[model samples]
Target: MMLIDGKKVSTDLKNELKTRVEELKAKAGCVPGLTVIIVGEDPASQVYVRNKAKSCKETGMNSTVIELPAETSQKELLGKIEALNQDPDVHGILVQQPLPSHIEEYAVTMAIDPSKDVDGFHPENVGQMVLGNLDKCFISCTPFGILELLRRYDIETRGKHCVVVGRSNIVGKPMANLMLQKLRETNCTVTVCHSATQNMPELTRQADILIAAIGRANFITREMVKPGAVVIDVGINRIEDPSRKSGFRLAGDVDFDNVAKMTSAITPVPGGVGPMTIAMLLKNTLQSFARSHNL
Candidate 1:
């Protein structure tokens, strides 16, 4: 079985973007600027924000991080978003997820201008994506990254059966839509299974390409996958591993050890979808920058 090396793929994409960013900088006399807002002190969110900032510097882009206290009011956060929205220097704006219980996530999403919403959670961008208007839409990063991986690998999707296990807005939903788009290398019959799905294994066994995004560890077993199928595991869960120094190991939804034996290709947990998400986020930020400058 071939391992889908997301780390290598993401590095290649970032290198390509770095070169383009230099060209844009030389021509426009400015680099792309991205602003990330994080509310509360969620450890995972903090780490993600730090990585994003590092990537911006690597690509010769400008980045800013705004950290608000856990008790910051909704109005206060919205006011900050509005300020960034009007800032010409800031092209992309992202607010990390899982805000404090007191804050309304939907309200925060709507406050950001669609053009600056690099996270692609805004209503306008999501609507545009659903209609297949790629020209104006910024797709959710993880789904966009998955498509890039498939495209780069030259996988055949036309008229094939694509099964997506999970229905979360972030990965599963957008992924299904992207697979169904009538574009080059992406027209497929898409099936989505969620928590309520019955005979789930039956549906999965028919897939030419299987996407596993359910938030559970080792959820997709070998029997559920078709032989020679391409598996994309989008779930990341921490499970106890006493053998490791950290005492926990990261695992994807698919049981990689057993499932890989059944599939022709598959993505591993840590190095699979994680790096791609960041790469796509950087790409979206650059796209937002280009649009801001009318380039």
Candidate 2:
């Protein structure tokens, strides 16, 4: 069995983006700028935003973080988004997700201008993606990253049976759409399964490529996966574990130890899809800048 090393792939992608950004800078006299908004002090959200900012700096792009207090009103947050949208210097806008329970997530997503919505959660961008006009909108980071990994490894999806477990806008829905697109490597027959799906195991077992994005840990076991299939784990769940120093451990939806033995290729939790998500965010930011400037 071969392990899909996402860390290595993300590094290569970042290097390629860095070189391209340098060329754009030399020729166009500008580098991309990404603005991230973080509301409240969620530890996990803070780490994610910090990683995004660090990536932007590494790629020679401008990074801005707008920190808001936990008690900040929704109106205030929307105002901040509006300011960033009008700021010509900001090429991409990403609002860190899972905002405090009181805040409406969809409202914040809609507040971001479509052109600067690098997170690709805006209605306009999502519509463009559903229409297969990627040139007109930024695709969601995680789904785009999945396609990148498949392309880098030369995994052929054409006419293959691809099963994606989850229906969230961020990962599963777009992933299914991308795989079924009329493209050479992505012309797969796609099936999307959610919590309401009956006989879920039977559906998953028929897959030539299985993508698990359900937010539950160890949800996909060896029995659910077909032998010699390629598995991509998109779920990142934190479980309490007293044995660990942090009193918790990170795990994917798949039971990796057993599933790894059955699958021809699999992505490990910490080193897999996680890194690629951030890399793709940087890529989208660069693309947004280029589009805004007509470069």
Candidate 3:
């Protein structure tokens, strides 16, 4: 089985975006800018924001990370979002998830301007995406990244069976919606399985393309995968590994070793969907910039 090298694909996309940003700067006298707001000191959130900021700089885009204390109130955060919404320099705005328990996550998601919602969590954008108005709204990065990988690799999705194993708004839901779009590269019969799914294996084994986003490590085993199917592992779970200095290693939903032997292609964790998500975020930010300036 061949590995779907997302690291390479994402890098190639970034290189293209870097060049576009340069041309945009030359024509519009400004580059696309992304602002990330972090509410707490969650280690994983910090790492994600840092990587996003670093990527923005690498792609020749402007970036700012607003570090807020854990005690920041909902009104205070919403006020900051409103200010960024009106800022012409900021083309994309993203608030890192898992806010303090006292804060309302839904309120924060709705506060951002839909046009600048690069994370694509705003209700307006989500509705537009569900209606297949892709050019008019931002799509969540992970799902967009998955479609990009499939298009780049020339994997056929038309008239195929796509099984998405998850139901979260972030990944699974958007993924199923995108795959079922009546677009050129999309248009698949999608089946979404979650905690309530019955006969999961029987359903999964029928997929031509299987996407695992259930957030469990090594959850999709060989028996659950169909031979020659394309598997996209979106779950990144850290399992304890005594051999590693960090005391853990990253794994995806699919049991890679065993699943790889059965599938025609598979995406590995850490190097797979992770990189693509960042790449798509950059692309979306650039698109937002272009739209704002009529470029």
Point to the candidate with the largest lDDT. 3
lDDT of each: 0.92, 0.92, 0.95
TM-score: model 2 vs. ground truth: 0.98
Q: What's each prediction's TM-score?
A: 0.98, 0.98, 0.99
Error of 2 at 260 (Å): 0.7
| Top-down TM-score ranking | 3, 1, 2
Off by over 4 Å in 3: none
Worst 10 residues of 1 by lDDT: 177-186
Better-scoring candidate (lDDT), 1 or 3: 3
User: Whose TM-score is higher: candidate 1's or candidate 2's?
Assistant: 1
How large is the C-alpha RMSD of every model relative to the true structure?
Answer: 0.8, 1.0, 0.7
Where does candidate 2 have its weakest 10-residue lDDT segment? Answer: 178-187
Q: What is the lDDT of candidate 2?
A: 0.92
**Residue by residue across 143-244, what tens digits does model 3's lDDT show?**
999999898888888999999999999999999999999976689999999999999999999999999999999999999989999999999999999999
